[model samples]
Structures are given as structure tokens and as C-alpha cells.
Target: MDAVLTNFANGDILAITWRPLLAGLAQTMLLSLLVIPLGAIAGLLIAALFVVSAGLARVLLMVWIDFFRAFPPLVLLIYLYFGAPLLGYEISAYAAIAVSFTLNTSSYFAEIFRAGIEGVPRGQWHAARATGMSWLQSFFVIVLPQGTRAVLPDLLSNIITITQLTALASVVSVPELLHTAQLAQATSYNVTPIIAAAVIYLALLWPLVRLMSHLDARRYSTKLSAAATQRRRRQETADE
Candidate 1:
């Protein structure tokens, strides 16, 4: 027990490693902030285009989504960081990670958004158009909101996934939380820093997980209530 505590729960090691771990945590947060928004915006644009696109353009969009979805993010990151220099282009670690994660995650976000958008009733689009609204306006003002709300749980879950994927940035020596923890572990000759990093990750991500769960439960309840209301209406109509 003593040896275990000394190796994995040493207060001295925590004191020594806290600063670097914090710095790493900050970097991870920054990376998440950058990539998450970039991916989301890019994905929104892509999905919008996919909706409005036709023929070759739609085909190309599908190809783009499929290619990125199939491609491994780590391989993409490594290639961007290392292969860019080989092709006579210098890319920093941050830039590489930013580009790779955006490309990879945007594909996923695009699919999610596309599914959400398509799930909206077609009549809603026609009704919006009948009210003298342009397609873009209808999509942005009416259909998009409903569609997004319908898929809020999935969107939040995807965001959580993207946040976790930020740890992969460490592979390129970007000094994210896990990498910093590894460095600290090496220096302190203890597992405490790694354990601390795990705790930090849990603390950060647990809220998102909870939020997603809440959204899912609420959505399910809404559906059940709507179903019950429909059944009651049918029963009342039959009585009438």
C-alpha cells in the first residue's frame, strides 16, 4: 500500500508536476476551442452546400465526406506535420493539428448536420417557401432550428468526441495534457502525473456527458408526450 501510494499518489510529485500539467491542460483547451468551432463551421457550410448541390457537385461533396470519414485522424495529422515539409511546405505542429482535425471532424459534423437537416419534414420547406421566403432564408430561419433541435443530443455527443480527440494532438509533440503528463511522469519517476491527467480529463468531460444524457432524456420524454397527445386526440375524435 505504501509503495502504491508513493508511486501513484505522491503529493510531492503532484506539487512538482502541476504547473506543466496546467500548461498542457490550457493547450488542450485552446486546441479544442480552435478545432471544434472550425470543424463545426466548416461542416455547416459543407452540409448547406450538400443540400443545395446537384449532380457533380453533390457527388464531389459525398466523396469529400466519405474520404475524410474513412481516413484516420492520427495518420492525417502525422502526414500533415511530416509530409508537408517533404512537399516543400513548412507547417507548424499547431497548424498541422488544426488543419487535420478540421478536415477530419468537419466531415463528421457535416454528416450529422446533413442528417438533421434532412430529417426535417419536406412540407416545412414548402410552407416556408409559400410564405415568400427564399430557400436559404427558410433553411436558416425555420427548418434549420427544428432540425438542429431534433439532433441536439447527437451534436453535443459529437462535440464531446471532438474534445477527447484533442489528446491525439500530443502525437505530434504539441504538448497537450497527456504529453505533459508523460513528461512529468518521466521526470518524477512516478505515475501520479498520469493519474492526475486522467482525473482532469474526467472532470472536464463528465459535464458534457451529463449534458448529453440530459438532452437525450428530455427528447425522449418529449416524444412520449407527443405520442400520448396524438393517441388522446384520436380517441376523442372517435368519440365525436
Candidate 2:
């Protein structure tokens, strides 16, 4: 342990490594924050189009989503950075990472939202139509609200996923945490900065992970009680 501590303390960690690491950490956090809502907005927009009948746009969107989700993010970053130049559109590394993360994250979010919207009880849709509401009106007014609530916990979890994925931005020279850590490691010739990066990531993600757990627990509790009440009510009706 003494040897380990001595090795860890070898370099001027605070003076040299911390600044760059913090800067990288800040960049990663900002990128994650920006990506989550942007991705969600993109996802929600695609999901809204689910109301339409089958068409070229819908088919194409599904294919795009499948393509990105199936494509590895790191590889996507590489392709976006290099492939775009070949197509006569040379984007910066930051823009490439942003576009890649957004599209990748949006694909998953889109599927979740579509499932949420579709999973909404069919009876409600029928009832809304019976009440003279147009299908679109019923979808936006009735189904969407419930669907969003049902998927809220999962959406938060996906945001956590995107946060982790920001580490992959290093591939495209995004100067994020891992990249910063690598630079520090290279300069200092000590592994402490890498450890620091891990701690920083843990500190950043742990709270959000706990919150997701709490949400899952609360959701399960609510579902269980609702089910129990439903069963009791049916029993009472049958008994009477």
C-alpha cells in the first residue's frame, strides 16, 4: 500500500493533471447534457410520426434507426469523421461526435417512445374516438401523456447510458474525460490520472444511477398496488 501510494503520488498531480482532467470532465458533462435533450427531441419527433400510416418516410426512418443502433458508436464516429470528407462535407471533430451521439441516442429513444405510445391501452384510443375526438387529437391529448409517464424512468436510464457513452467521444478527438486522462497519463508516466478519471466518472454517474433505481422501485410499488387493488375489486364484484 505504501509503494502503491508512493507511485500514485509520483507526479505533480494537482498542478498538472487536475486542470486538464477537469476541463475534459466539464466538456463531457456539457456534451452529455446537450445530447440528452437534443436526442430526446429528435426521438419524440420521430415517435410522433408513428401516428401516420405506412409510407416511404416511415420506412426510411425505421431503417435509419436500425442502421445506427446496429452500428457501433465508435465506428460511427470514425465513419462520420472520415466518410463525410469523401462525400464533400468535411465536418469538425466536435461536430462529428455531436452528430453521431445524437443520431445514435435518438434511435434508441425513438424505439422506446414508439413502444410506449403503442403500448398505451387500445381501449383508451377506441373510447377517445367514440367521444368524437379525432385520432390525432386522441393521440396527442390522451395517449401521449400517459405514454410519456410510463416511459419516464426508462428514459432517465437511457440518459445515464448516453452519459457513459460520452467517453467514446475520445475516438474523434473530442477532448473529453478519457482523452484528457490519456494525455495526463502520457505526460506524467503515472497511472494516477486514470484512476482519477474513474473516480470522477463514478462521482458523476452514481447519483443518477441511484435516482434511476429509486424511480424503478417507486414504479414497481405503484404497479403492484394497482394490481392488488384491481384483483380485490374484481373479487368483491364477483362475491357480491
Candidate 3:
């Protein structure tokens, strides 16, 4: 066992794969940090507009969201990478992923956020307004918090999906984690790098999935309790 462990820890597996993997890991992290926040913020703004807008404006927003949401991020990345230079605009692979992720995930974020906002009780809005708060004030103060909490599990799922999509950057030669792992495996003629990368990906993502499940469970429990309380109150009132 010690010998097997020693072999796994040293030589080509450790030395050759680690540097490239680290580089890939950095790029993956950088892309994630950039895309997640921007996508979330853009989605928030669009969702707000969806709530406030009516008629033509709402239709336009829906069209935009659907158009982007329906697009595969890989296709969008391909188009941006290969199609841009034709338009006399040069773009790097990293730039392509950034743009694609931002646009595609924004649509998802917008939809999820709107769902969250709508899930909040309408009474909350009236309560805020009763205190002489403006529409915007009520949204930022009361609605946003509850809405965000309501949609957090969905948002976390999206983030996890987006994090994995970073692997798609490899198609454009972006040298992300998967890309480096592929290169390492090809050079060493060993499956170790491939296995290592798989492990790394799992290590990074499993905790997120577990957390999302926990939050979803908690949210469901809260709703169940609230419903039970409401039913109990109604029963007591009827008896009275």
C-alpha cells in the first residue's frame, strides 16, 4: 500500500501535471469570479425591469432573455471566437467564454430572480409602502432580501453549472483545467492526469451540490411549517 501510494505521489504524475493543472486552475478561478458576479448583477437588473416594465418593453426583455437563454454557451463561444474575426473584431478564447457566460447566465439569473421576487408576498410590498417608502426603496429594502433568499438555491445551482462550463473554454484552446489535464495525459501516455483532473473537478463541485441540497431542504421545511401554522390558525378561528 505504501509503495502504491508513493508511486502515485511522485515522478511524472506529480511534477509534470501539477504546474499545468495549477495554471489551468487559476484560469478557471479567474473566469468564474468574473462571470458569476457580472452575470448575477446583469440578471438582477433585467429581472427588475421585467417586474417594472409593461407592454412593448416587457416583450423586448422577454425576447432578449429567451434568445440568449436558448443559446448553448459552447455555440455562443464558438460564434464569438470564430465569427468575431470575420466582423473585423479579434477576440481571444478567454474573451469568448467571458462574453458567452455573461450573456447566457444572465438570462438564467433574470428568470430565477424574477421567480424569487414574485414568490414574496404582495403584502410585503404594501407594508413597505404603508411606511411611506417609495417603490424603489421597498424593493431594495424589503423585496430584494426576501427575493434573494427565495432564489438562493437556484442561484447556487446556476453557479455550479457555470463553474463546470468553464471546462468548455478548452474547446477554444483556453488552457483551462480540463485543457491542461488533457495535454498532460497526452504527453505522459498515462491515465493518471485524467483521473487526477476528474478528482479535482469532483472535489471542487461536490460540496457545492451538497450545500444546495441542504438549502433546498431547509427552504422546503420553512414553507411546510408556515403552511402548518396557517392551517392551525384557521382551525382555531373556525372553532371560535
Candidate 4:
């Protein structure tokens, strides 16, 4: 342990050893950027399906949601990356990793968004409908604004999960952060690079967590203020 600590402190982590590390970082960033938007769109669609469907469609949607929620991302990656090729359509390692992570991210984000949508009081939805707004308009303009604020924290946490999940790409040779660290350990026979890699992951994820917290706080405070104003107006009207 001391030897590993010493190597890290000495800055013995040079560019040659950093190649895989940088590659892994790149893949992590790429996967995050690609999947986040797709996940948001998928989440919205899934939420809508759950909201609007009745009977069997709702049951089927629940089953699909439960299946993805139960499935581990790594297992899904391995299946898509290694096993899918055996079935006919051969995808490269990077593509496999991207698709699997996107789908996984989508499933979880869908649930987060669904919960957010459900958080809005049913009265609010009825009020918007009473004002002649279509259900779609109410969802996009009012419900989603509120839901985005509600779900931002959970969704940001999922970003960290996806960042860690990218490491599974290493198993398929996509050469993400963990794999890079392992390679560095193999070459130097020292654990320092691996330790540094863990620190780097924390560094990358911490800012996102902090930012999401800040946003959630601001939004929640705003909502509370608006509610207070509305309550004051109601009290004044009753007195008049």
C-alpha cells in the first residue's frame, strides 16, 4: 500500500501509461453525452405510455419496466457485446457498450420521470384541462417543468451510475477507466495508477452531484414561494 502511495505521489504516472486512462475517460464522456439525451426522451415516452395506457398495455409496460430495472447493466453489456454477435447482428465493442448503457439509463430515467410526473397533484392536471389546455400541453408546459425539478437529483445520481457503468466496457475491450488502471497496474506492477483512477472518477462525479443539488434546492425554494403567494391570495379573497 505504501509503495502504491509513493508511486502516485511521485507523479510516476506518465503519458505512455496514461494512454489507456485517457481513452477510458473519453469513452466515459462519450457514453454519458450520448445516453443522457436519449434517456430523457425514452423516459418521457415511457412515462406517457404508463400514464395513457389502460389494461394490458399498462401491464406490459410495467413488466418491461420491471425487467429492465431488475437487469444489471454489466450483464446486459456482456450479453449485447458478446452474445448478440452469435445471434447474427455483429456490433463492435464500443457500439455494444453505448447501446446497453443507453437502454439501461433510459429504463431508470423513465421511472424517475414517472415518479416526478406522479408527484404533481391531480388537481393541477385538472386545472390545466379546465383552462382548455390539452393534456400534452399541460404535460409539456406545466407538469414537465415541475417534474424536471423533481427528478433532477435522481437523474444526476444516475449519471454517476452510468459513469461507473462505462467501466464494464473494459470487459469487452472498450478500454474504459478501470481497464486502463488495470493495464497501468500490470505494466508498473504498482497499484498507484489504479488508486489515481478511483480519485479521478470521484473528481469527475463530484461536481455533477453538487450542481444537481444546487439546482434542486433553487427549484424547490421557488415552488415554495409560489405556493405561499397563492395561499396568501386565497386568504385575502376569502376575507373580502
Best by TM-score: 1
lDDT of 1 by residue, 1-240 (tens): 999999999999999889999999999999999999999999999999999999999999999999999999999999999999999999999999999999999999999999999999999999999999998899999999998998899889889999899999888898999999998998878999999999999999999999999999998899789999999999899788
lDDT of 4 by residue, 16-79 (tens): 5666777777777886777777776886899888988899999998888888878988899989
Residue-wise lDDT of candidate 2 within 152-212, one digit each (tens)?
Answer: 7888889999999999988777889999998888877788888889999999999989988
Consecutive 10-residue window with the lowest summed lDDT within model 1: 181-190
RMSD of each: 2.3, 3.2, 3.7, 3.2
Better-scoring candidate (TM-score), 1 or 2: 1
Local error of candidate 1 at residue 144 (angstroms): 0.9
Q: Cα lDDT of model 4 overall?
A: 0.80
For model 3, the stretches where C-alpha displacement exceeds 4 angstroms are 1-11, 227-240
Relative to the unseen true structure, what is the C-alpha lDDT of residue 187 in candidate 2, on a scale of 0 to 100?
A: 79
TM-score of each: 0.93, 0.85, 0.88, 0.84
- lDDT agreement with native, every candidate: 0.94, 0.86, 0.89, 0.80
Clashes of each: 0, 0, 0, 0
Task: Give the Å shift of residue 33 in candidate 2.
Answer: 1.8
Which residue pairs clash within candidate 4? none
Q: In model 1, what is the error at residue 135, expressed in angstroms?
A: 1.9
